[model samples]
Target: MNITIKGKVPPKAIIGVVILVIALALFLLKEPEKDDLIEISESDSIIDEKLEEGDLETTPVIQETIVVELAGEVNNPSVYILTKGSRVYEAIELAGGLTEEADTRNTNLAAILQDEMKIYIPSKEEVKAMEEQSGTKAGSDYIGGNTTANSSNQNKNSKVNLNTANSIQLQQLRGVGPSTAEKIIEYRNKHGRFNKIEDIMNVSGIGEKTFENLKNFITVE
Candidate 1:
């Protein structure tokens, strides 16, 4: 008997269509989920923000102003520029350390420094005299008997005027200390105006040597 042809497709074509459907189903299932992808991106964004904040905190900051001075027996005594909070040691190091002759024993390397302070390194004679004074050693002229010599020197120079002297004017003279300064003021109160610089000879304790020292450092006019 002859078989009638049916409307169904061929076996090879059916197989091909089935295979295509399976491939499409797999593609749809394997595609990334939008919510999952969004969650991952959100986690990455959080990490980025945290890292940014951390980086900001770790950044170094610089200070605007810093100044320091080194003086006294240093190879080169000078003021130096520094970053804020830099220590005295740093400045000393910059100046090439202390000279071989510098007396470092009395110096405090760790001392915090200020601007424009005079750091004096005393000479050997000066140091010895200071020590003698402190110990009150016999035969040491720690009381400064040199005042007599100073008096004699002052007498040789032009005289000073006590009554008319302004502090500015008075300080210009050598051998004038606070005590002498006060004396001049007192003399001014007792006496009227000074007739001339020569009138200073009348003041007690002033002499020729002191006047000579004052010559360069003072002015009569």
Candidate 2:
């Protein structure tokens, strides 16, 4: 349908109308983009949090150290710091190595070090004195008391009298500590004097292995 108008529109009014249309279009397009950006930001934040949690789980923990006293014939005898699983030799080394007179033959250098343990290193002269008193040679199978005999008579007189020996005497045998020595005395007291050396095995904690180590050194007669 054709219609006739007799008025002219102002240039400023037309320009304002055009500007309003452009602004409305821009707002509609930007709204969806803003919503998309917000969603992406939230997802990135979640991923970053998950990564941080993973890093924490994979982090390594450090082990704690132990303190021990290293004494005896070492050059420097004092309390030293060490890690777990350290051996006696390491402790000795930390103490500035052994002295010239230190006798290492009796020391178990390969033994594991314990906290507050005292590693006493005896002198060579002291070991010799002990050997002379024990009657058997130093570092021999015989443990505890003094013995004196020639090589031909060594084994004959070196045996410990199990029936008559007290707890202190019993502790002189290799592998016989205070607890094991006490057990032996207790067993002997309860069951009467051991009739045979094998009867020592009847004591609690004195197993076959202990008996094996002690058989040569002990006697009932």
Candidate 3:
């Protein structure tokens, strides 16, 4: 159909059509960029959450502890806080170790310490005098050592000599039992002799309470 409807097209209608086409093109181009921005935001959020979780996992935990009271012959004798399973040697180190007059012969440095336990270190001269009074030869009757002895003779006063007392004589103390008596003798034999009645508490199992029960019946002489 060759219909010649000449004249010019409407300028307003052409301008409107062109504007609609440009707007459609802009929307199409911006859609992918909007989606990309959303994806980047989601990824950052995920990374932040993971970092927070990692921080929680890497936190440190504190260890359990025990309190022990140290006294006698140490440089600084006071109550000390120690980690559980700490040894007697460690406790001594915390208390500034043994002083010049400290006699550590009866101290079980390797023994694992208990909470509220007290340690007493005797003097060297005190131990020497006790050994002399007991007339105990240096190398005789060593517990778990080479020499052996006959049954110990009790003193006239009925006090057990911490230096020369055998297991049987040690058992005569008020609170001393078969095991504790053996421990006393072993301590005496291994470390020379008890310097004073208080030094008996330096043994592994003996504490302040045990010392109280046997103190009156025991003597270093």
Candidate 4:
């Protein structure tokens, strides 16, 4: 058959034009080349790997916190979460500090702190009882309980704060009994706080001999 537009067209020529159009359409709609498909797949795989690995190069905002527990003689005894590298005093301050009956003579207040550690502040009466049972003064200046294992002793070991020590704490000093501890307290109340450790001699009983024995163990706050 022949179709007329401007002139008559032969069947062979019409068939040739139709075949060319079909070939162009087939080429446009053909599946992508193997190389193109592989490139797309590789890009997607890279993105998935980055997502899975959490983009380690990009610094993630991670919070480094530590948990500590405080018990006995503090105003509030409980577990506390603190910033990493926090010390024992920070935990105590967070727990509202020591109570009136809290005995710190045998405690290492300057000790560094750690995670999952438990700090126990013994009571004065409990300390006295322990002393009585042991028949000697408790020599250990470490806090009683499960403390940090890997913490370095960075701070110098603390001595008793003379200006702040109570009667019981003062009695823990060498050559100071209950009566002498009271006398020291009385002197503090009348004349005011001791300016230095050497001033303890004014307490009526703490002479040069006693001061020599206890000087190494006491400190002013």
Candidate 5:
């Protein structure tokens, strides 16, 4: 008995079927790689955004301060830091306040403080010694920025301190009467402080000639 074929198959049809199978296999294999690339690109985009946000910096804030030193006749004398425009009495209070031997009459507690200022709280005996040595009455006034551990804080070489002087202290000046003293105080109050001794000329009626005469006998300190 001889073998018999069921049907005739075309070479082109077989070739076409082979090509379709190869194409289907390639498409299936490439799908995972395409999904992986998409996920990696999305991950890279997120990482780049985080890096850009991390590159930006935040600004810092700064605050002004005043450093002063309080010594002599205070309970606890040391350097202290305070806000700008802090007064002398506030510094003294930070230093634990004045002791019993402290001569309050010679210290200007109400004066506004300046940076790097050194305050010396003089004793009563020290004030007397200063008065005896200077051959004059020297008390009830002391301007900012002084240093001398164990001496009077109000001498200013027996000259009046124009900055911290009260009405009575100002009257002790050669030509300053009560009205001028009030004007000086008013000027200081209106402004802030006498940065220099010549700033007194800015006051009403205290002219250049008056300043020349008062120069050697007064100071802003």
Candidate 6:
């Protein structure tokens, strides 16, 4: 003999199965990735901050030009706004005037000016032509350029007393020679300090014209 059995689910079991199916479907259709949501939130916050601020303060950039003051031995010493290629002489012109003792003869007045160059004035004796004339006229057989020979010879003949000369002391003066420079030194040693510049004339070969020329560049003190 054979026996058969039939089974039917309860109403609660069917309801629970339906609820689980709904939950699984919701999870499968979820919104977006967590990283994407976080990125969207940060972007929205940044945009909100920008919109909240009405205006932003911006710093201004300024370009500046420099000006310098020049005085001392110059025709017109004063404050000058120099361009890129100004020279020493140009600055000197800004100042009122140069002292009579200013030694400009050695200066390359035509030379370009640096950032802070001091253009000094020259004295009468520092660039005297007499020494040049004496050297040229003393001997006409000189083969060098007529004008150049005279100046060259004069420069060669002129000697400086290193021990006693000032800034202008090394300049060429009339009748100055190696012997004269030595004599000037000897005098300074024997007689002590020179109270006056005129004492240079006391040395042999330093005539009145030489002394006059030297007066501009020389100082005893």
* Each prediction's TM-score versus the true structure: 0.36, 0.42, 0.44, 0.36, 0.49, 0.25
Error of 2 at 154 (Å): 20
Per-residue alpha-carbon lDDT of candidate 2 for residues 1-221, written as tens digits (9 for 90 to 100): 98988799899999999999999999987776778889999999999998978755555788767676655567997888888767778988999999999877755577565554455666676566655555342232111122222252345346767654534446668888778866775565345557888888899998888889999899887
Which of the two, 2 or 3, has more TM-score? 3
Q: Candidate 1 vs candidate 3: which has greater TM-score? A: 3
Residue-wise lDDT of candidate 6 within 1-221, one digit each (tens)? 78655687789999999999999989978968899999999999988887788456678876443354554445565566776455555656656556675655444445454343333343444345433443232211010011111233444444433333422233334545556654664454344456677877776667788887777656543
- lDDT for each residue of candidate 4 in 1-221, tens digit (9 for 90 to 100): 99768967889999999999999999988968899999999999999999898886766687778777898789999999988766678889999999999888755565556566567777787766656532223322233223222112323334655555545556666688878876775565445557899998888867899899989988765
lDDT of 6 at 163: 35
Top candidate on lDDT is: 5
Point to the candidate with the largest TM-score. 5
lDDT of 1 by residue, 123-172 (tens): 34433433343212111111101111112123334433343343323543
Give the winner by lDDT: 3 or 4: 4
Off by over 4 Å in 5: 1-62, 130-141, 149-172, 177-197, 216-221
lDDT of 3 by residue, 1-115 (tens): 7889789989998999999999999999877677888999999999999898875565578888978767667799888999988877898899998889977664467756555
Model 1 spans with C-alpha error above 4 angstroms: 1-60, 84-86, 123-126, 133-221
Rank order (by TM-score, best first): 5, 3, 2, 4, 1, 6
Clashes of 1: 13
Q: Rate residue 50 of model 1 by lDDT.
A: 87
TM-score, prediction 1: 0.36
| C-alpha local distance difference test of each model | 0.50, 0.66, 0.66, 0.68, 0.73, 0.51
